[model samples]
Target: MGLVIIFLLVALLAIFGLVRSIKDKNLLGAFFAFGSLAVFGWFAIMTIIYNGFPVAH
Candidate 1:
């Protein structure tokens, strides 16, 4: 639902941050970004799998 969408957006931003951090050689930023990506991405995927797209009210 709405939560899944928010998680996906955050995960997408994390991907961008990961790329930027790698390009800038910022290890700490990259680490945090990667962690964010993993957590948010996992949540988004699991939510979709468990609840189905568009979800049921």
Candidate 2:
């Protein structure tokens, strides 16, 4: 529950960052936004794998 909420918040922030980056036409900002989003996705995947896929088990 808490994880879901946190992820949701991060997602919103990431989207905001992405939009800002796009509007500013900043390559660095866009890179950061993508990197942050990738890290979040990595964490989520790791959590699922560690917890047994939440489906296989």
Candidate 3:
């Protein structure tokens, strides 16, 4: 539950960062935004692969 919320927040922030970077025409900021999003995706995928979500009760 907690980790899910954390990831959600991170994902949202990354999306916002990407949008802001693009709007500002900042290439470096865009690169960092993509990196952050990629790391969040990695964590999400690993968690799902190991736990299979909701722990099967």
Candidate 4:
């Protein structure tokens, strides 16, 4: 539950950064925003696979 909430918050922040970058026409800011989002997405996927779909005998 807590993880989900944190993830949502991070996602929102990333979106906000992306919007601001776009409005400011700053490529570096946009890159950072997207890179952070991709990293977060990868972390979420890895966590889900490790916990939600564990392999056991």
User: Which candidate leads the pack in TM-score?
Assistant: 1
TM-score of each: 0.93, 0.59, 0.71, 0.63
In the range 1-57, model 2's lDDT, one tens digit per residue, is 357446646866877898899899988998898787777766765665676444322
What is the C-alpha lDDT profile of model 4 across 2-54, one tens digit per residue? 57546656867888998999899999999999888777767766676666743
Descending-lDDT candidate ranking: 1, 3, 4, 2
Q: Residues 1-57, candidate 1: write the lDDT tens digits.
A: 888999999999999999999999999999999999999999999999988887456
Pick the lDDT winner.
1
**lDDT: worst 10-residue window of model 2:** 48-57
lDDT of each: 0.96, 0.72, 0.81, 0.76
Candidate 1's error at 16, in angstroms?
0.2
lDDT of 4 at 22: 88
Candidate 3: which pairs clash?
Answer: none
Cα-based lDDT at residue 53, candidate 2: 44
As for candidate 4, its clashing pairs are none
The TM-score, computed over Cα atoms with residue i paired to residue i, of candidate 4 is 0.63
Model 1, residue 33: distance off in Å is 0.1
TM-score ranking from best candidate downward: 1, 3, 4, 2
Of the candidates numbered 1 and 3, which has the greater TM-score value? 1
